[model samples]
Target chain A: MVWNEKAECMSREEKEKLQIKLLKEAIEKAYNNVPFYKKRFDEAGVGPEDLQSLEDIEKFPFTTKADLRETYPFGMFAVPEDEIVEIHSTSGTTGKPTVSGYTKKDLDIWAEVTARAIDMAGGTKKDRIQNCYGYGLFTGGLGIHHGGYKLGATVIPISAGNTKRQIEIMKDFQSTILTCTPSYALYLAESIEKEGISIEELGLKSGIFGAEMWTEEMRDELENRLGITAVNIYGLTELMGPGVANECMVKKGLHIADDHFYPEIIDSKTKETLPEGEKGELVLTTLTREGMPVIRFRTKDITSLNYDKCDCGRTTVRMSRITGRTDDMLKVRGVIVFPSQIERAILKIEGLTPNYQIIVTRPEYLDEIEVQVEATPSLFSDEMKEMEAIERKIANKIHKEIGLRVNVSLVESESLPRSEGKAVRVIDKRNFD
Target chain B: MKIQQISVFIENKEGRLKKAIDVLSKAGINIRALSIADTSKFGILRLIVSDNKKAKEALESNKFVVKENDVLVVEIPDHPDGLNTILGYLDDDKINVEYIYAFVSNKTDEAIVVMKLENIEEGMKALKEHNAKILTLEDIKNL
Candidate 1:
């Protein structure tokens, strides 16, 4: 199932050599073409010539999301506007969306990397890919679409929503591969059941789900519900789309296409590179991007990198699944808690549905966290004392996980908002100002 | 005989009790006797209503967590030693009383005590052996 075995299974020495060469060229291109990189390089007093080896990238100034916002639309593009063949921008919910421009060559590299991702997920030319990542401005849809095409698979560009239609097409077309965000995939699975379609009737063999942070418990739920091998894909709109890295059939971790985009783990606070196997913010460098060659782009995603060769026979370094974003981590009552921790704790309890909402409110002078979880049919009881005990158990588990005693509220089933895309899990009502 | 008591979970907040009462009143459900067991976070408002089913439906429709359980309604003299005499009978039989709340009956010189016990049958047997007057659901409704 290894795609482009030569590229993926290259010897460590050979891959590092290629990475060093690409890194040098990308740095030179960024400094000479893009004014932003040139100014940054000048400020850091480190030029492209200083990058002698792959490790030398540490001297470069790290590019951040804020830096991308400052540039706005096309400040990061290294090539002329005429050569740019495609553009993708983030949702920009936080502020202005950071735009990523790609030349025709850049698009080809994107397709190649995504094709490798598809291959890693056990996809082949005969497989039908039902891509549900959303088309238009979002890179997820088109990214997987082009990658499926490159792999010579029959790509169904259904592009997100219309749950009934998605189920119908999936059954009729006998799609062998499914691609979308993990949350949306779960939602689609729920819809498929609601539509009275048996999971066995569908021809899905595997799925490539990513774009939002998810937990291992979520993976188990998706796999059990859909009867497919659920694998995690890692990518960002700021980098390339969904093709940056993907988990193979081995499913140990996502295998990064380090040949194209170099991966690094850095201490988010210190802005220093962390050694392999240490969890920190993931920073990426587009080693071969022609249109927008970025140097040391801080992704802000928290994860660790594993250089150990995967059992799938790929020598390319793999990254552990993202745990949380530094920006999204919540601080409650002076205790730092990630929404993923709450999710993990809730999922550990039997008979509770995965759907939940964490509300952090300042009632008076103290901060309180209230976790409203949906009560599944199995969890709901006729006895009030039994229900109260379940609530107390959930509170105790969450308290053990986050070191903060939170109020657990058992809400009606499906009462919480399900995401068509990313599930909004946390609502912080405390005004920091 | 066991009497039906409806317990509504009310959060410890302003006007929550009023809101629960409002729902019952709007539904034409009459409250017979009520007691609240509270903690710092929330309260369980235990009630003896004229119509258990109607009161439960009303509170539940308003999104309240309501539970129905059996409690023994025993008739005790309105004098100071009435409750102590009943407790002494139950204690001698080793029957545990989880909770007890009472209201004076206007029709007689006796007070009606609602007793939630660890074992309702055992507690009732002990009370009957001691010649205690246990009121049925019909008796509480008429009162």
Candidate 2:
């Protein structure tokens, strides 16, 4: 009942004054209670008194993923386990899973932020949302679920799988809005067509897709198929999951909730902060997080920032679509590639299954990549010559997409492994010891 | 009849294969039968062509790593004895057969045999004396 569009649209001065007050309180609480921050401040030769404004906030040391790893699970937690009502964690693909806890008040604030995200993407209480994000340790599902409830929408709480049943319920429940990763949305679209279901008649209106980067070309494709607007939502488990920012109707960069979470862009390698409009890594400091207050937490996502007011009413600073992660990018044959680029290229080619793998190996002392792509029955025939031609076409298109040539092998459709959770895009064999 | 066969060494890189194809495309050399023997390193590209001489010259003139090797193409009846008859000669001659693949036959009642041999001239002599139909480039191309 308390969607604050007016507060969201407030002038910069008004928001800054409020942000400063919240930031001060949050910093004070962290310095007093959190041992990690207490030691960091002691080593920096600074105290809570050094932070008069946001400028002095930089004197604080930056926290890296390694720091979270060092602490393991819940070592940085500001409150006891009993006071913490909820816990969320990273997927742990890279190493040990990093966990964060949230008190009841923390959950309330998180829900409010997510509600703001839903509202900006044009959701209403009358809408029925089919939430398709993965649940459990992964924060995407529960994070969006809490927000959808706070917004008073009829949330289906259908965590990510069973596409048949999901599509079935979309029609049965007349679900108006959908939330999931862009990869899964396209998967659902394929299912809808295969089952001879009418997506247009389902009364589905809009979608919010995140957890992975997608392209404008993919957006156009999904929009054409589903006849609905697909917006981008961005967040990470370390940063409190899928409501840190969202795209408004303007379809510009995602608007960050700067009042609650102050965002800064810094050079990933140098660790030096960059000015607005410059592309760099994102760093966030939670101004109002209760249980797990993070200060200058380095988020390796590579993107530019937009401070100019958007056509949409929100005055919060907007961040561009993440081009690539500093660590997620791969250097093959002197060419830098992000997995998202491959997804974009595959999506552009109609009748090509999105399930594919990038197998990187050092064969004969040179970096080589073979893209094992799956062929839809409609796009290929059993004839070896036909398969060869399709393979050539895919290789050529991929060359155009990433500016690097890749060996494309056409495998049987659905032969490539499908992920129940996040799809593995690249397998690097660089021999990292 | 003769069956044209051509072999080229391909570096294991992304666009190298495309460049090779582009070279063949520009030269008007139509590939009849092709296979790649890939290792962890570079691949050996083997092809049985409609015009072996033309493919060889086209590939060579373009500075492609090309070679002409005598790989025996022996005809066998489309029955079980087809393999035994060919292997009997090779086994007697003490010539090692590296690998073998059967080709679709253009002939009415026989299939074509392609084999890599350690001693090419010795194997050819044995096949000829054994009344084996030694397939020429054109013979394999037509079949």
Candidate 3:
């Protein structure tokens, strides 16, 4: 079901006109109020007036995550501090977190997009939402909370953790919708099974899982185990959290809220815009953001966009599931490998847990990768040869997938660390410097 | 008779074997017989201990990957070709011996051979038909 027919189902021409109008205003606002954008525009020899059409966005320089880090806290905010009512930041696990501030109108837009997202997941005012996203400086928690409130759904702001309590409350409250990272959803499913509660006892009808990259195999697993329709929610703190785009019940692709956030796909190497259905890096421009108006913000996420109207009847452009991040790609022995590829290989093997860690090391100037996977009870046997054969089989499968021979080590069950947030899947010890 | 054997995964690094044994020794668990099958990268340290469950818990608590496997322990006379006699029975029956490790018992004039076979049940039956003394869990622990 489309959430806002006027906004989500507008004609392409009408949407483009709205986007171009807002895009010009956003650029002018950033150019006039933010020194960083002004200097960037000055250096590029382009001004806000240069944007005659939406295509003129290509003339602007790309704003990168590093640029966001350079600005640090509040440097990217276009509005005065007094007008900014809410602030959220990235986890900054790699470095400094990028801060995003929102005026009252910006918060309403956030809620509007998120409400659309929740509605696309089949959530309504009668539905109870158990939001498991963390609630601190991270935008995920509050992003969904605001959306659920805006949708007038019964919002259970349980935050995250305490798995036992989450399960208990989910049962007692009969929450109809669940929201959290996909990894945490799997963890919750495992916990629910261990707790010996039948999935039918819980009244969950759908899940809004996002915040990290997950595979289709994982989605199927969650759906089968939890007995709910699992859909992907795409968002970034720089744009707006948890609601920039969402997969409708059609589940074809995530529909971007075009009127609020303009989406573009650009070639990663060439920095040239690619046509729809062509895979490239995603660059976003917040068309209507008042507090932190970002222009051509280069989101390192890689995916293709489809402008064809979705079967769900939403005219907003849809982006394919994020395949990989440009920065997360690993070069092993001169061949590019992604953690998702390795994960897909591991999941294909029966009796193997989805939990795995890829370790890349440089021993004697040759790059070697070791995939450590947790062994389930069925896979663990006393016969050393049987175990060795299983390890060899895993190594061969991974070799077939990534074209690199890797050592497969079978670790004990539950030995690997589990994360409530994004799961760390790779450890590269090769120092290129 | 099937003997419970504890196998621990040890990275092929210096003092790793020592560290694994230390965990068991500190737990007051006695090792009856032990063998290590290793490659260049890592090794599997297999042990027949006084108590398989306790040894497994101790090693696992100390962060070792421990697995319990069933192996056949047979007593052979402490003489020339004693092991060969037991192997001949299995070879005649077409049972493949995956691996075998032996230890001489101080309490008896017999050496004990721990054998892992491709078809463990068939190998055990062949050994029994040939009148080979298969050691029970209690027999190995007492020895």
Native contacts, share recovered per candidate = 0.03, 0.00, 0.19
Model 1 ranges with Cα > 4 A deviation: B1-143
Cα lDDT for residue A263, model 2? 89
Candidate 3 residue-wise lDDT at A275: 92
- Using TM-score as the yardstick, the better of models 1 and 3 is 3
Whole-model lDDT, model 1: 0.88
Looking at the true structure's interface, with contacts defined as alpha carbon pairs within 8 Å between chains A and B, what fraction does model 2 recover?
Answer: 0.00
Q: Which segments of model 3 are wrong by more than 4 Å?
A: A196-198, B1-36, B40-70, B103-108, B135-143
DockQ of every predicted complex: 0.10, 0.02, 0.26
As for candidate 1, its clashing pairs are none
Write the residue-wise lDDT of candidate 2 on A77-132 in tens digits. Answer: 88877999999899788898898889999898889888888888789898898899
The CAPRI quality class of candidate 2 comes to incorrect
Worst 10 residues of 2 chain A by lDDT: A377-386
User: Per-residue alpha-carbon lDDT of model 1 for A1-433, expressed as tens digits?
Assistant: 6779899999999999999988889999999999999999999899988989888999999998899999999999998899999999999988989999999999999999999999998999999999998998899999998899999999999988898899999999999999988888988887898677889999999999998888899888889999999999989888888889999999998999999999999999998899989999999999899999888888889999998888889999999988899999998888889999999999899777678899999999899999998665456443456668888999999999999999998764454787767789999999878
Candidate 3 residue lDDT tens string, A1-433: 5679999999999999998899989999999999999999999999988999999999999999888899988899898899999999998888988989999999999999999999999999999999999998798999999999999999999999999999999999999999999889988998898778999999999999999888888888889889999999999998878899999999999999999999999999999999989999999999999999998889999999999998889999999999889999998878999898898888888877678999999998899999998766566555667778989999999989899999998765566788788888999998889
Clashing pairs in 2: B2-B136, B2-B137, B2-B138, B2-B139, B3-B136, B3-B137, B3-B138, B4-B137, B106-B143
Candidate 2 runs further than 4 Å off: A381-389, B1-143
- What TM value does model 3 have? 0.89
